[model samples]
Target: MKFRKKVDKVLGTSLAIIMGVMVINVLWQVFTRFVMGAPSSFTDELARYLMIWVGVLGAAYISGKRMHVAIDLLPSRLNKEGQTKLKTFVNWVIIIFCLAAFVIGGLRLVYITFTLRQSSPALQIPLAVVYSVIPVSGILIIYYKLSDIINKEL
Candidate 1:
């Protein structure tokens, strides 16, 4: 559990750094395009790549923070004992579905692209690099969900 928390913190920090880099890349692109009259073709591509990293890494951070959008009305209404039970049920359901969709669908997407040997158009980077985030992010979600369930039960 402690190890997982540490990993989550590392991933969160990496996400923050990637987001910062993406912002800086966009700023540079704008400055060069307007002020210097020399727009960069590669910056956009880099930004896009960084965006993938940001989103995947950020998902785990948001999950850890409990920041994802939720309709809390139902949970908010329950009595304390009922609420605890319902919360556990909801956590289990969430873990099942999230892990299933992310693992199954994400794997399919990556497999198709990998078999095709595709690459990004402007960046010329392999498609696998772009799509690798799917599984990494998915697995992270699975791990965190397991942690949540364990913590709740204990």
Candidate 2:
């Protein structure tokens, strides 16, 4: 419980900070483009990259809170034991999907980008850096789901 709280706090704080930076970056971009009559080169790219981080991290945070959208009609009709079993099965499925599609796939993507020396045009940062959030969020989601399974009511 303590660890979960800590993770939640850190993830929340980090997301807030990233959002603040993104807002400031966009404001500066607008100021430069219209007010100053010249657009900043890096701000657009930075905002785009920051958006990726925000989206991916936000998904993880939502998953941790178990606030993701779900169609619960089937589960709602089940008995308590059936519900528990279904939830466990669903959680396991999520873990496997995240592992295969996010962690493994994301790492492969990052490796490829790094190998090719792919970088954003305006900021000249490696694409792998932007993509790193995939595996990170995958891990976070996996952790949350495992916690759910362990702490679940039987």
> TM-score: which candidate is best?
2
Q: Per-residue error at 134 for model 1, in Å?
A: 1.4
The lDDT leader among the candidates is: 2
The true-versus-predicted C-alpha distance at residue 133 of model 2, in Å, is: 0.4
Candidate 2 lDDT, 50-120, residue by residue in tens: 99999999999999998899999999999999999998999999999999989999999999999999999
Which residue ranges in model 1 land beyond 4 Å of their true spot?
A: none
TM-score of 1: 0.88
- Total backbone clashes of candidate 1, pairs 3 or more residues apart or in separate chains: 0
Worst ten-residue run, lDDT, model 1?
Answer: 145-154
Q: Which residue pairs collide, candidate 2? A: none
After best superposition, candidate 2 residue 115: deviation in angstroms? 1.3
